[model samples]
Every structure is written in C-alpha cells, then in structure tokens.
Target: MPDHLSPDPLHILHEVFGYDQFRGPQQAIIEHVTAGGDALVLMPTGGGKSLCYQIPAIARQRAGYGVSIVVSPLIALMHDQVGALHEAGVEAAFLNSTLSFDEAADVERRLARGQITMLYAAPERLTTPRFLSLLDGLLSRGQLALFAIDEAHCVSQWGHDFRPEYRGLTVLHERYPGVPRIALTATADALTRTDIVERLQLEEAGRFVSSFDRPNIRYAIVEKKDVTTQLLRFIEAEHAGDAGVVYCQSRKRVEELAATLAGAGINALPYHAGLDAKLRQQHQDRFLREEGIVMVATIAFGMGIDKPDVRFVAHVDMPKNIEGYYQETGRAGRDGEPADAWMAYGLQDVVNQARMIDESPAGDEFKQVMRGKLDALLALAEATDCRRVRLLGYFGEHAVPCGNCDNCLHPPELWDGTETARKLLSTIYWIKKQNGIGFGAGHIMDIVRGKKTDKVAQYRHDTLSTFGLCAESSEAQLRGVLRQLIATGALHVDAAAFNTLQLTDGSRAVLKGEVPVRLRASVSAPAARKPRAGRREAKAASPAAATLDAAGLGRFAALKAWRAEVAREHNLPAYVIFHDATLAAIAERAPQSLDDLQGVSGLGVKKLEAYGADVVRVCRGPHG
Candidate 1:
C-alpha cells in the first residue's frame, strides 16, 4: 500500500494530493464524510470541490472500508479524473462505455479483490442491474466505502443542466444506507439547492456552502457591437496565446464563428452536438491536450471539464439564465490566477433568450422560474455597481464591491431615462392600439430615433404623433433602456409574433410616471486596446510568471517544455501531469535536490519519484 493512503485526511491531502493545506471547508467536509456522515457540498469551480470527496476516499479506503464509487456526469471528466489519480499513485479506475468488455471485467475482478481506491461511472451505467450486482458484491466484501455524486444540481429539474438520469441516483442513498454519500455541485441557486437536497434524499446530510465569488475572474459585459471584432480584440489585447472558450447560442453560429476565428489566425475549433460523435471527441481531445486552442462551442461543451488553465470564457450570445451563466463563466481561471469572464450581449440576446422561455413546452410555473432567473442575469449585465455583488446576490450570498470586476474598475455612469422610456413604451402602446399589432425592437427603435427606412415607411408610422419623439436619444442609449424595461417586466417579448414588443401590466407604472427608469449610459469601447491584467487584483497570464526573475523565466520555460513532452508520451493534458503553478514554484525556488523539491507545493511522493530528478536537472542549467 502507498504511504499516503491512511485514515488521516490531512496526511492523504499533503502526501498524495500534494497540497500544503486545505481551503475553506475542505478539511471539515472530508473529516465529516470520512467519519461516516453524509454531506452536500456547494463549492465553486476551481475551488477544490473535488478534494472534499477525494481526500475522504483515500482515508476511508485505507481504513479498510472499500472502493469509493464516484458518479460523474461526463465521460471526459471520468477519463481525466482517473488519469490524474493514477499520476498521484492512487489506484483509480472508471467503468464507462469506452472500456472494452474484457477490460471492464478485469476492473471488476480487481474491484472484487479490493484493489481499487476510487471508481467512477455515469449514473445510467451505475443504475443498471449488472452494475448493481457488482456493487452488491463489493458491499458484501466490505469494499464499498462511499458514494460521490458530482454535478449534483443535475438531479433537479429546476437547474439549467438537468439530467433525467441523475434522478436515478437516489438509489445510492436507498440501497447503501450505511455508506456515506456526498452530493456536489459548483452552481446552484436557492431553489436548485433545495431540489437537490429533496430529490437526492439528502435531507439528513450536512450542508457545506462556500462563497460563489471568483474574484480572480474579471467580469465584463459589453453592449454587443460587432461581437466578432470585439471578441477578437479582447483576446488579442488581453489573452493572446491563452486557451479560452467562446460560447454561442446556436450550432450554426458556433461553426461560423469558429471558422471566422480560425481565418483571423487563431487556433479555433468548433464543438456542438450536431457534429459526429467521433469528431466531437477528437475536438475535445485536442482542446484538452493542446495549449492555446480556442473552443468555439454551444452550451454542450463545458459541463464537467476540469481544465485548470483556461484564461477566459467569452460569450458571443447571452445564456438563458443566471445559473447557466454563472456555471459557464466559472470555467475560467481555475488556477486561481487572473482570468476574464467577457460577454457581449445586446437587445437581440435578451429577445432570443426571452423568446425561448416563452416558447418552451414546460409548465407555467417552470416558465415563471426560468423568467425570474433570466431577469436576474439581465440585471447583472445592466448593473452599474459591482457586478460581483449582483452575481453573488442572485445565489443569496452577499459581498462588498469586488474591486476586480469591470464595473467596479470603470464605474459606469447611470443616466435617468424616465422620459425616454415613456416615449419608447408609448410607441409600443400606440402601435399595438392603432394597428392592433406589436412591432419588433428594430422598428420601434427606428420610430423612436426618427429613422424612416423602407420598413418604417411601409408601416406608415411616420404619421403617428409619437414618431421620432426621442430623436435626441441615440439608438444605443434607447436599446440599453429597452433591455432594462424588459428586465423589469415593463415590456414583454411576444415570441409568437416575430419577437415583437408588447406592454406588460408593469408598463403602466412607467407610462404613468409612477416609476423612474435608470439606465447605464452608452460608453464607447476604447479604440486602442491595452492589457487590463496590470490593474489591481488582476493576475498575469499564468501564476507567478510576471514576478519571476530572468533566470526563473528561462527555467520555467524549460520545465514547461519538458512537461509537454512527458504529457504527449503519456497521452494526458500537461496540467494533469504537472500544473503551471507547480512548475512555476519549482522554477522560482530553483530546487537543487530531491529533499529541496519536497518542500514545494504540489509535489507528492509519486510525482517526486516520477519527475523530481529531471526537475532538479532542469533547474541546474544546461551544463549540469
């Protein structure tokens, strides 16, 4: 048995996982679960949520309990997680469709012999009778240690990433009542959290909720203006040569934008479910293994990815709601380094999102909940105060202005647009009243701005008394005003009627001047782009790169190159073998011996045995 495996959480954490200490509630959660207590953990992505269960698995297994079963949602997630554990010298295996029949049987034989520490599988496979029997065998042999359900929010229909298969996971609690189970998710609002607890039958479980704030990720939502150009500029100025994910709303848009990005000399790849499964896997593999590859994808791409060096997450179109938005943007800056959550949304994004909700086949109650979530996201986007505060407040957590977000740094000016809003609403009200029809955003904006295009002339809206009433207001300003109105429920987007605007009952307040309308003034983006990472609380491209000396920089580069070659030989992501933080620490310290390497963080016994000598050689310079 490995020396790190024991009934000691801190010993396993440092000796196996190679971390110096626990963050937040990790130690507490691990100790609780290891002591046979059920838990529900809500830690943010990159917040070391995995450690909450992983440490317990090591401790419990060493205590002569049994193999821990981890119910993961994605095949990619399972593959990488198991690989990482193997690198740490822990015996972890995953049983998914990717394994051959004989290979799976071999794993089953080893599992029966109490050889594996942690085993990962999808919920669908785990719920099947054959796997259940195998689990029964393990239970009879005192080999079933615990159960870990990752992405626990999927069990709830209210969450954005609901999976019907996750509902079947209630069997874990019912069948293995004696085994402690921990349900984990990084993103869940109050309702989703409640639903997860209810559906998973974790009512008796201890709840561990960590702060949702990712202060290292700078939040910026720009008003959409040629999103492709803006995105390219943002990448070029801020994150050139860094890996990122760009999300679009549709499959067609994903492919087109990917091609366009590639044309602009970027290493971009498109990923969506519309593509062949083999091709999708290939793209995902390349994204995981290669550096500086931008993945232009839909919501389908980023569910359980554990890539830790993603520098940014850009959105060409807005997500449907706050949960989805929070989960998606949380993918960036997993290394605790400065990263960006950049998005470009405009009137169409709001309309498209609202239209999807209105047109969905869900029940009215579900639709109402979805709408409320969307409104919160819009409020975040339109907020002039701290974006971080607005985001965390949605999850029922409060915080002071994080001096890191774009809003906190720039301090957008808010203009009172009460009169302008009335004019815009009057156009909708009169058009619906006179013509018995609602008009979409374009025509209404045109009428308000006094632009007599071909559509406006054909509609014959020039003769209306409200036509061009707010000619002084720029189209951008009015569009901003329109977004706020929709967000506030003063206006509704009728999806059945070509996304036309109609006055809601809430509009009466604004029309009667009983409510004041405040809007974020339209500010032009800076023409000449400069790096924003130099600002306070922002980080460099990678951890500690900016602060390293010249010799340290050279040593860091050599270590990275060596790590890349080894990663290719092992067919794993470089970060999985050794993260940039670990390499940077090694370079900065210039460790001269194996004893010296042990003091650096992220250097466990197995890793030290595997690569410690090579790292020391790299640090000693070319002659050595």
Candidate 2:
C-alpha cells in the first residue's frame, strides 16, 4: 500500500465529499480496499455504494498510488458520477463509446501522464485490447491504483440484469496480480453474490454485506382494477409536484402510459430500448435536472440513476421477482427521505409471468427457478402482515412490522378461508373431470357465481352441482382468495393450458378439512389506500427536513434554486453540486460565514473553497 493510503479516511471524506462520518460499513470497506485488499460489497441502492470505492480511489491517488479504474455498466452512469467528482474538485474522467476518438485519445494521454485521479470505463471498452494494453502500460509504470467493478450483480446469470460481457473482466486479476480489486453491487442474493465472487475471480475478497432495508420507503401493493384510473389517482393524491418513476413491463405500455400521464397534465416521458438513443438520453437528462418530472419507462430506465429526491416509484405492472422489485423500489427515498413504493398487480400479472416463463428458451431448471421466484413475489403482494417484514424475510433478514406499510398501517382482518378454498378447488376439479381439462379463473369464477356465460353454457357448466356455490362472495373477493391460494402453493397455473387453474397436492388437504385456511378479508377497491400527508405533515415526516422551521424551509428552497443555477452553469446534475441532505443541514444551521459553513456536512475543503462564500451569502440572505 502507498503512504497516501495511510491518511485518515475520515479526513479525506470530510475534505472531499463533505461528509463528516461514514455510513454503515463504508469506512471499513474503504480501509480494506485502500490497503490493496480485494472486497465484494453488497449494499442496497443509495446506500453510498459509490463511496466504498470513491473514497479509497481518492486516498490512493493522493498517496501517489496511481489512477483508480472504475468499470461501470452504463455510460450515463459514468457521466453522472464523473461530473459529481469534478464538482467536488476531484479529477475524474470516463472513456466509453460515447466519446469521440479525439476525446478518447485526450483522456488516454491524461491517464498516461497520471493527470487523472480516476477513470470510469464501460466494461465492454475496458475489456478491449487497446484498453488492456493501456492498463498494461499503466501497470508497467507502477501507476495503476485499483480496479472497481460496479453493478457487480450483472456478472451473475441469475440476476435480473445479467450482462455476458462482465464475464470477460477476470482478465484484470489475471493480467495484473498485484492490483487490488473491489466489486460493488446494489442488489444481490446469496446465489448472485456467490456467482459474482466466482465470476469476478474474487473468491478470497472480503465480503461486506449491509442490511437491505430502506425504512424511509413505504410499500403498498394494490389489486389491479381500472389500472389507469388507479395510477392517476395515486399520482394526484400522493405524489403531486414530485419527481418519480412509473415502471411498466413492456415498451408499448411504457409509451401508452407516458402519453396518458402527459395528457393528464403530468410532465412525463417514455423510456425503453425502442426509443431513439438520443431521445432516451435527453429524457434521462431532463429527469435528473428538473423537478416534478415523472419518467414512465420499462425496467430499462433506472439501473444507474443517481437522482436522490424521487418521492415515489409506482409499478403499473408486476415485476417477475422480488429482487427486481426490491432494486426498483429502492430507487425511491435515496436521500433517506420518506417515499412511497406503490404497485398494482392482479391475476393477469400472474398469468403473464407464467406465460413468459413457459415461452422462454431457457432450460427447464432455469424456468423452474424463475417460477419459484415469481411465487415469492406473489406471496409478498398477498401478505396480510407487514409488507416490510415479509419483504425483508425473502432476503433472509427478519424485521418487525414497520408501521409504515399499508398492512401495518391498516392491518387486515383474517377470515376462515377453508370453505372458500375448498369450494374453489372443487370447482376446478369438477371442471377438469367433466371437461377433461381445467378452465381459467374467469370461467371457473362464472361457474361458481352461477353466471350463465356463453362459454359456461357451451360446456354445460351451469348445470353442475358446483354452480352458484360461491354466490355469497363477490368475484373480486373470490379472485383474491384464489391468488392467496396460489401464493401458498395450494393452487397453481398450468401455463401449457392457457393459464388454466389447477390444484396442487396441498389442495387435497384443504378439501378434506385436514387444513384450516385463514386469509385477509377482501376489502373493496382502493384496498391499499394510505392517508395522504399535507405539506406540513410531509415535511414533519421527513427526517431530513424535520429540523427546518418555516423560515428554514424557505431558506432551503432558496438554496436549492441557487444550487440548480450553479449546476446548470457547470453542466452537472443538481445533486452533484450539493445533495438535498447537505442543503437541509446548511439551511437549518443558517451559517453566515465560511468558518461556520465549514462545520456543516457535505461541504468538503474543495467545495468550501470553491463555493463557500456564495453558500454563506445565500444562507445569510440580503439582510445579513
């Protein structure tokens, strides 16, 4: 390790990033990586995963350890991070396909001269022969600092966003055995973590796994009914004038929903693989730079978005698994402010997911694993207990009822669903026995509810003994019950039969009265409604803004406006200049001088020297 790496990381953190202390295991991870040791960091999104490598990079460079090379998956992510580093007075650059040949050559020259502190490269570019030759040159000159592989979960084939190119990254360790390597990921399960370690050749790397809880995010899953109307109502009631992301599963849906939201007067944009590359980039830039802009997109939108003030993330369609759901929802409340994760899912989501799995070209084992994962998410959606507790439990963490989620805020009453389960299962069995195949939920529901539809009459199902057996229950109530049954493994969907309802072995127990079923009583539409907090209540609820009084709120808003102007001037994201948390601290403290401003968090020595006077003037206002 270089002597500069021996400096107190706290000193570097306070001077560079303006943070007084490290969060969670950041300090330890930084120390380990800076000491020329390998590490695997598993942290939730917005958990400061960047700093785990950034601080060490700066420390190593300051000590003359050479340039830190960051292998990222997205060019936009590189731009955002490097821009922030520049505003903090750190010398950073990125080389990717986006750069012109001349621009790329300039960056290369800088790297050769050791003029840059860090270099961010796309994994594809980093694995190229030219880049590898450049790295060899840097290594020969003893100017290579360390390697940071971000989005390490992409290395895992089992992960949601798997990239085959990441597998080629092992050349770093093979070619340069002395250079330390650190792999970081925002989302990863045990299996994915293991795969990351193996694939990245970090089998002996120190593993730092942080808690996967985002307490500031309130989770609510509603049954899909008139989805467009429900989505509009959610936006109007809970997230008016706030920046957010609405995730859809398909590109067409993304476009249609974006139009719908825009027609309704929400500043919305569509983003997906189908859009022109430049258009997608422009939309992403606007969302990062402006407030109250909602981006309606498929899963393509939010892999590396660094926006911190997104107040909500609404899912118009269900994700295929819990990991994807967790990673997507984790995008909200990144600044540790209170945010919402609202999703609307129904039986169709289940059918669609099953159909997708069945139609996929992946092997049977992979398909089975995917089906199991989807079932876990279904269980979470239909859970009657605290959503936070159940969600955490899926990741092997046990948590208490959060009191912030829909279930905890309004606990559902349990009803004896044994009779109901038996009735539904018997109806399915009867249909299969009589017609030689099972029917879809709708047809089965009509049979049980005694609806004489054309299909039901064509099959002569209206004359069966099971007809009208569930007339006391509404269609919605029966659907909810069936969904819960599927979640619990007593029922399943036969994808080969067009998602026909089928009974599992467990269903036999329920039908024989050997098992008792208790389920959340079905409520009407808007079952997952949460009480909307007014402005005062919202500010009071936000821990970051809680300390600010009326005057302080005004000051905070003024500071934000000034920051926005400075960001525009520098062609950087607003948060790059100063995060909302840092601004809140400054507004609450009301620092009137450089000396006083120095005490605030997030005002490092470089930033303090660069913008300290302006910040003090803004805080003091004209009266001072």
Candidate 3:
C-alpha cells in the first residue's frame, strides 16, 4: 500500500519527520523496533527521542496492515503530538476525555476503516473496555502496527510520577505478542529502568541507554538557609526577565514566592494542584506564551510540557530523588543554550520530603527506596568536585568538570572531613550509649557542642559523655558536618520508628578510629541569591542600547518584528525559538554562511542546519 514501508530508517526519518539525521542511538533504536524488536530508550529531553519510534511507526504502517498505537501519559501531550503530526501532513488522531462524543465516534469510525496511520491514547483510556475492543478490532483487521509507550518512567513505582495504569500496559504485549513495542523515557535510573523492563514485561527488549549527560545545563546547589531571601536573590540576579521556573516544595510557598516576585515588579504566577483547573491552565498557558513570565510552582507543575526555551530551573526545595531532580533540572536548556540548574537545598528540605514520603500510603519498602534516592541527591549536592561529574555518575555516566556550574566556575576549598566525621560519629555513639537514647539532629548537635539549651537540659543530654566533644565547631558547622555524614552513609535515620540518627556499620570504622573520614568544607551560601549587581548596573547604564541589541542589534529588525508578530499569532513566547543572547551572538558574529555560523557557541549542528541560512540572510538585510 504505502510502498511496503521502507526498511531503511534514514530514508523514512528524512521523508516523514523531515529530518536529515539521527541523534545518539536513535538509528539503532529505530532498527530494533522496525524489526519487530522491543526496546527501552533512555535519552535526555530534547534529544530527538520521539524520532526513534515515530519513524518506525510510519515505516510499519506503510507495510499495508497496521496502525501504530501510542500510549502517552498526558492528555495535553497527546493533543500536541497529534496536532504536530497532522501539520507535518501525516494522519494522526488521539482519543482522550477531552474529545467530545462526536469526535470520539468519528475517531472510532476512522479506526475501523484504518484511516488513521497512528493513534495516540492515554493509559487510562487504553484499559477501558470500549478502547480495548476497538484495539482488538484493529488488530484483527491486520491494522495494528506496533505499540510505542511514552514516558515509560511512569511505569516504575520508584519514579516521581509513577502511574498505576502504566503497570497494566503489559496487556498490550500479552494480547498482541507479535507486534513490536518501544518504551521511551528521558529520565530513568538503573533501578527505574529495570522496573520499567519488568513491569512492562519487556524482558527481550533491546535496551538503549544513551549518555545521561546534559552538558549545556550548568548545575549548582547552594546550601539553603533563608530560602525565601535566597530564592529571590538568585532569581533576580541571574535570570531576571528570562523564562525560568522557581520550584517550591509546598503550594503555600509557591503562592508566597509568586507574590514576592510580583511585589518586586516581576510578572509571575503561582501554579499548584490547589488552584482551579482552568486557572492553572490559564497560568500555564501564559507562562508558555509570554516571555519574562516566572512560574512559581510545586512539583506538580511540569510534566509532558513541551516548552523548549526555558533558560533556568531553580529548586527552592530539594527534590525527593536524583531521578526527580534530573528530570526537573533537565527542563532547562533544552534548546542547547547555556542554562542554570540552581538549587537552594537545606537539611530541613530533607526532613520535609521524608515527612511527605512517611505520610504517603506506600509500603515500607517504597519509603526505604525513596529515602535512599534522597540520600543520593544529598551526596550530589555535598560533593566538592565537579558537580556535573557527581550528577552524571549517579545516572551511570562519566563526566568532567563542565566548567559551567557554580562549583566549576568557583571551585570550593575542600578540607579533611575525616577528623570531623570521627568527632560527629563518636558524638552520636557516646550519646546513644550513655543516655540509652537516639535523638534528632538538633539534640545530638547540642550534646556534641556542649550547649546547655532548654531542650538539651530537658533531655539531660547536656551532660552526656560526648558533651562539648565538638565544641571546636559552631552550631551551623556541626549541622553541615552531620549532613555530610548522613550523605556519606555513615549515618542513617529511622523514619518508621521515632526519627533518630543511627550510626551505620559504615560508621563503625570511623567511630573506632580505625579509618579516616574526609569531607569537603561547605561553601558559603550565595549572597542572597540576587541578580549580579554588575548585570543590573549594565542594564541600568545601557538600557536603550541593550533593548535595541536584544532586538538583534538593529540587524534584521524585520525578523524581530516578524518574531513578535508570529509569537502573538501562535500564542507562544518570542524567546521560545531563540534567546536574546543567542540573537545577539548571531548578530555580532554575523556569519554570512551556514558553515561559518555553525562555529558559533550555542548553535547546535542541527539547529545551525535548520535555521542558520535564514538567520544569516536576515543579518545581511536592510534591517541592520
């Protein structure tokens, strides 16, 4: 029918997706799926992951007997994908609750006639008898191409956004064993990846694990003390008027931070589950469509969102796991420009996160796994070496000092943590043995510091054997030392029982002075997380010229005009395609040829090939 759906993926990739190349392991993945093989792809966000399966879907559909069924997690994502495919002149339709009865019936009729090449349905919809019956009908007619599962990380119980329905996706393979299946996610650790394989019954799937490194995003974690002031300062100093997200652990914090930003004359909005659905959607839409709009949100705000030009992602609270942190921070710099993954994390954030997990309806095993993940995130934050290396190492990738993160930009001075660890562990030990008690971090700290606080006196912890043992350190320094101990696996917290610090077997050697424990001194917290005074001064002194330069330095004013016009026309942010820095870089470099422009920083090879010629032509026009 459609020329037997060429087995060559590169041809199909160019013809259908209008792309001339494959990224990373996309070609290998496409071949695996097209050969009726199962695959799990772990590529980063904006890494051209969709092309892996989408091309194969078209190729299989052309072979005369199949329609590819895509199971997506988000309704909005389904709509956006289907709309994009339709615009590319491909036949695609999605079925979800958002569709009216008439629309549903029309899609159903189209399915029966095999008019649709690809169909997208949410997991909740797929399990319904109505939709399963429709799928059976299509398969019986030789109209089932393959199954493509998006956001496969949701299938893992350990993942941040695990969906129970995803556990049921195994039915697709059970019912249609011969059909190819592909499970794709941009974020999944080794454990989560294994869970995806097991839960989805993809034992035989060819796993494609790409490098989990996002080199363009600069990672930094500031020890969060006075988070509100820290957050305000960070947002104002580094990312003022740029598209960024300020994530809080609570909705109340989201509202408060949004109000703070607004009071500071910023266009900001609050987004959380507590808000009305319509209002949340409106705020999301505005954030997506309006440049310079800051979105203050809790963890629930971003999933399956396709905004490409977000420049920074600041975490006002620590995310629960490295997977969650990676996924959230991965949102920034999707355009391959320099972006900030700034976090203001403190010990309280850990307790609050643990409280949330402990209060959840999950099993003890689940809570333990979550706690382990949180511990891993803490290790990353406390690491004194290259932040990128430590982060990528968690995801099983090796990296060098990225020379972009704050730590890389300003390397911290590390000290021997061994003596400090010994003192801290010894303090925990002596306090436990003498008092027959395991206490919280604060009480233990007081005992170590020999402080006679009221609470310390109430517990008679002030006169413990370990009293004044760590008197050399201040209250804050002792807390930092303890945090590093916990991160290093020398200490554990028993959340199920009373929350108490328990020395692990790993701490035994340190307690016995059999081995040395070393730690890096924590950096001084950033000065109030505000915009750099120099940047502010630059803007203040050259406001007019800066404005004009942001408009492409007067070159291609018409392009700027067109960008603004089209941004309004499409209800999208003008910066979504390119940031002002990118534009300025292009204008200043003014590469007359595409080859020349490819050398400019921030212009990835694909982007250079895609828009380089046009940008150069615009640079040479009379608008300059």
Candidate 3 has a TM-score of: 0.84
* CA shift of 155, model 2, Å: 0.8
User: Alpha carbon lDDT of residue 493, candidate 1?
Assistant: 97
Please give, for residues 399-446, the per-residue lDDT of candidate 1 as tens digits: 999877777777777889999999999999888887899999889989
Q: For candidate 2, what is the lDDT?
A: 0.87
- After superposition of all CA atoms, the RMSD between model 2 and the true structure is 2.5
Over 1-624, each residue of candidate 2 has an lDDT whose tens digit, in order, gives: 543234567877877777878999998999999989999998998899999999889888877789999999898899989998887888999998888989999999999999999999988889899999999999999999999999988988889899999999989889988999999988887778888988889988999988999988999888888899999998988787788999999999999999999999999999999999999999999999988899999999899998998999999899989989999999998988778999999878887887899888999989888888888898898888899998988888889989889888887877887898888899888888888988888998888898999999999998888899999988777888787777777888888888988889989988898887777675324454555443335533234666678889878887888998999998778988998888888888888778888668888777888898888888888777
Top-TM-score structure, candidate number? 1
Off by over 4 Å in 2: 1-6, 523-546, 622-624
Best-to-worst order by lDDT is 1, 2, 3
Better of 1 and 2 by TM-score: 1
> Cα RMSDs of all predictions?
2.1, 2.5, 5.5
lDDT against the true structure, each candidate: 0.89, 0.87, 0.76
Would you estimate the TM-scores of all the predictions?
0.96, 0.95, 0.84
Model 1 poorest 10 in a row by lDDT: 532-541
**Which candidate leads the pack in lDDT?**
1
